[model samples]
Target: MGNLDKDILEKIDDWLSSSYDEETRASVQKLIDDQAETELIDSFYKDLEFGTGGLRGIMGVGSNRMNKYTIGKATQGLSNYLIKQFPNQEIKVAVSYDSRNNSQSFGQLVAQVFAANGIKVYLFNELRPTPMLSFAIRHFGCKSGVMLTASHNPKEYNGYKAYWNDGSQLTAPHDKNVIDEVNAIASVKDIRFEGNTQNIIPVGEEIDPIYIEANKALSIHPEAVQAQKDLKIVYSPIHGTGITIVPKMLASWGFENVTVVTEQATPDGNFPTVIYPNPEEEDAMALAKKKGEEIDADLVLATDPDADRVGIAVKNSQGQFQLLNGNQIGSLLIYYVLSAKSDLKQLGNNPYIVKTIVTSNLQADIANHYHVAHYETLTGFKYIGELMTKLGDSAQYLAGGEESYGYLVGDLVRDKDAPNSCAFLAEMTAYFKSKGKTVYEVLLDIYQEFGCYQEKLISLTKKGKAGAEEIQAMMAGLRQNLPTTLGGIEVKEIRDYELSQTTDMKTGRKSEITLPKSDVLQFITVDGDVISARPSGTEPKIKFYCSVKGTLHDKSDYLSLQNTLEEKVDRMMKDIVG
Candidate 1:
């Protein structure tokens, strides 16, 4: 391209002369001959980074894009690391993909790389969700695994998520060490393209039954499900991998009346039904909501592309459909699990649940009422898995969730699983229905027992290189000028997770925080409001989490208290941004 950086030109030349496929070379040459300056700069300006999860980028024919070369390099690097980590043992890895375009080819490419490197590979015969990949790794006793899907992202993007033997994403030293090995890859020629087909074993039929049975074992009230087997439920997979297992899981859990949104039931990479293939958006769930109304269903559930997160809709007190945010869902799930166990006298010794620091504190109050231990980790699910691994044999993990619709019920799979969550959610609906109460009534009852807690998340996205720099600058500005008061209330404490210290702003006394270092800051006000600021690890955006609470003495006061909390959150956000 004309006026391109010299180094970028050199990289382009290298790719042209390298051992890449003919199609890739033709695309690069066309861009150069056409003098596509903007396209060239965006494609070749920098290399795509393998973050804590693994590789994710827009697919194209450049170092910064997700293509055959980048996928091969990541797989080779992971092969090398696994070989070193498990010396003297036969290293094995599992591979799976989603319904996205080219995902099957990319997944086969990964399996070939691992097999070429003399590593045993267990590849799925067809597309599966990310959670099943995690379960397969632990079930087969593989040393590592890789999943090829961009969870809830747009159609143009794809990603690779690496997992360890414990079935969790990389954490701490392992994550950084994998990055070093990937960066050391010098050329496309270094990747092994030819493979021993015998080393690649297809796995699906053997694992699906076990996985489904394991989830069915998590149900606490099978009797209630049997009694209320006719509870009308509507579901939509949003044209993702959930269509493969979610319906099957529901059937096995003794639910009789289940309706699938036929239009959105098929798995398609283009996601033809919605603008964004995410359950968090109301527009994405519009079709399912309409289906629920026509059928007079009691609940509506929607899952994203990879089926890792789930969102639900239920009738409110006024007999109108209302969407429950992630915080509300998490609260209801934890309350159901804990209270059921307590009622059955199944609360064992040292029982615990986990949540992220950005999640609602209502979880902690629920745990206190049940006399169970509650642990808070950083924002990622890997951190929750890490804590679970660390507390091995000392505590039992009941369930855990984040505020972004990701959750897990048992310890069999370390990652968040929608199939498992859906099964339990259906059971939860049946249990309350058996008692002649709607889910909305159960939620109000929970709030009345424990104070009403409302939370909102606002994300500001910054796009390319300049946008990244601007996000960092915004964080720096907040750290440099700490607000003394927010929402007309005095600031009581400041917790700087980056420094691993909590400071009493009124007295200037600091206390050590016993958690891993992260670039997050939290401001706690005298009125019991919490404001947290942190950047997204997977996307080019920064997020602000605001939480407020009020007394809900009666069902009539619900609307008034909700309005007051919303106003308080608005004021706090304004103060922080100003």
Candidate 2:
């Protein structure tokens, strides 16, 4: 065997000869007997690191992969932490999963492990979305929660997302604390694999209606929905868990002319229609787009596999259906909410909003126009959730979103929710229609009013050990030598999140940024361009976000202005890396 193969085999041998269960041993032995060299190697490469997002990897038999044992170990660690953290309190955890191949099984394993540790477990009877799991954690007043999902990743992948009592993913000391607990586990023998049947409660049917009713009350422009009840909309779930509640959420919202994409409607773990199964990908929304074209629908919407994020399509000025990036959707939602509720007498003047640093600044610009305070957090929605918890009682949060199609309307749930976003996006369509406008027209007007804000994201995937080392080197190089300029504009400010320092180029003054330490670098150009570089904590990739903005004189300049901004983004990318 090759050196790499020998290393993998040694890891597998350790698991086989160690204290693993009979079934796990038998599975590994079967791979050995069948001479499945590639499978064995892939499975034993390394243990899956429990990052802030939780555990995620291809489902298989390995110490590092996503399987019953891995899930159990993670739950055991989390359980230990919960017991220690809340010694005097009753420890309860909510568990839910998506429509992936082994999602339900993994979720059950988690519940069983938690229950074995004397913690109460509220488990979903069937596959559910991730957002509900976030909501359930807070709704049930649980200490922590777990969701079995990989978000928009392909079928081969599965994951676990851990949440604290605030309904947000762990941050700062908590994230590190959980990781330490998980690593302290020496072997499978450390896990409490035995489960208590009594503590495991099936919670789907009881919770579904409660979630729908709560969401319905969050609508700000119900009058528009009442007026335009027959608003034409096309939706697709891309063969995931969205079908479970999206249509139901819309029906509850009083949308009557909704058309479901039949071929892509069902809940299938394999995701037969698209290779990526991410709504952000055009190919994944093919059926939805086709249906929109055939019916001449007003708008099209699609959700990722786990239903945490959503993508949209609207009729552009040329009468052609075009996909709206995350920034566009985020901006439109904020605009609709602010403009509609500005006249609401009951609404308070202390209304606040949120978006990630990577999200388009158009949101901040819009909020400024309405005199609302918009906060910027780290890339993850969990940070947005953290802000909500920190500012509880002190400030009223209106909404928050990121550039990856994830959004949260109201504080009902502490995570990015597609069901809520779907309902609101449809309502926004109706609200615009009531003013003799389409959703597309509202977008154009927003651009005209707030300057045409353009943003682009580029991700570079570097796989395996060598890739990891290369990415580290790239980050180190950037930190050591800051770029002087980008897109022909002087770099005025540099924020290194890892160091929590922001340096002004003109005065050479450094100030502390009050946020958790993260490995991110952002540069603000002299001409109002914002460029941020970040490496994914969960995936083996690095992402660069370029944002540029300019005033639009009229509707005729929209396309040309868009193209000019695209060119500026290209030049910025080359300057930063080349």
Candidate 3:
């Protein structure tokens, strides 16, 4: 009791006295009754800040955690904003969730809150991918949408992702405006907890077919798929919502030899297979990779819990299964989609593509080779979705991706889509197989054509109050003391995204960055190396992205050249943060 802070005690008391259910209230009271100071402080330290994207944290009964009350408040606030924004409208919203511990319950809570506020809700009947929620919003012409997921976070974590009518997450004025509204709900009494069952419509069976049908039309090479229909394909959902649709998406594209990793196929919030359910982690995709080896599969794919991002493994030149980093997968996806379409002389008018600034520049090079317009958005897929909506009717979107294994194809969904990516990726593999090539060979060819591009991401997680402060201090130190050189290359330019300014190191000339403000820093070397450091918006971590270039005139030099670039990038990162 002595260690518990005064403010934390007050917050705990509020929850205890509020209309929270007996279990929830008892959970909160137990901490106080047992004199659990540290646990109590951690839970009640501060209200989980609903960031630009939405709420995410450990699930528990406290202000600083993800619980029914916090999610309900966010829903009530979003409902208020929707009603105000679309006056005299039906005010429909799409609600879906992943298989996280409380995702289904949280999704129900969201539907109930929205329904209580006189908003029509189309909720998923079962766990579904995050992208499907985006698709539902567009298909139903809803005013907004919310998905209950933490993407690839750990088992204890859950989150909320809010989307706009255009099928994209909130951007610009809307993001800040929604934050304002969420903050305006100063008390639990202000939230509408009771739900109107009439207003909550269970949806999914009708939407899945439409989503699968829409994804099938994105295939650029049906003949190739037909020719190589027996392509060995292995995939795992990592116990997320991907199993619900990925296989169907693949089958819809004419893939006949698809194998599912049975052990990791079920939708379990506990994510018992791997420590972190993220496909980005090798252990998480281990089952799929092993299955690929057992069958000597042509390719292997795994999606995160929400199925918006995918991780893939292909046979390298050595005939061994190798996992493709996000950059490589995204680059190949763009290359195959654009090249196949461009080669067939089907380049549509105003063809456009997108990637995050931290992603590989090879994507931009590929876009340029086909004379397609490309734009670099800030780090989030929401920004890409926002740009797509901004360029509506004027520019046709071909594809867009980030380095974090998230990619979207066509204009079907406004978010990064894994199920859609799986369909296209399998199709891309089939097309390559039809050409007597492997996915790795095409990647090497792309490197041979566009020079070898290598990029690496390193994230440092600092948790809780002290960790947050340490992250801020590290950024401040780096900002105040800019490195003169990294990886033995001269620093040519430094871009401060927070200040929206890019300054040339030599001439000391500063240019304006047109994108919105963000806390990011980039240092470009004279030798075509762009190293960026930015903090994660969702998780408590800082990510360092190192992109380097080298010549790959000979395919035999792929492994050595790649290793050299990796060490160089390591040295470059070492100079800055280590």
* Candidate 3 lDDT by residue in tens digits, 426-479: 999988888889999999999999989988889999987667789999999999
Estimate TM-scores for all models.
0.97, 0.96, 0.99
TM-score top scorer: 3
Q: Candidate 3: lDDT of 219?
A: 78
Give the higher-TM-score candidate: 2 or 3.
3
The digit string of per-residue lDDT tens for model 1 on 45-121 reads: 78888888898887888888899999999988888888888889899899999988889999999999999999999
Instruction: Score each candidate by Cα lDDT.
Output: 0.90, 0.88, 0.92
Model 3 alpha-carbon drift over 4 Å, by segment: none
Candidate 2 runs further than 4 Å off: 5-10, 26-42
Whole-structure CA lDDT of model 2: 0.88
Q: Which residues of candidate 1, in runs, are more than 4 Å off?
A: 1-3
Report the Cα lDDT for residue 508, model 2.
Answer: 96
Among all windows of 10 consecutive residues in model 1, the one with the lowest summed lDDT is 1-10
Candidate order, lDDT descending: 3, 1, 2
As for TM-score, the candidate ahead, 1 or 3, is 3
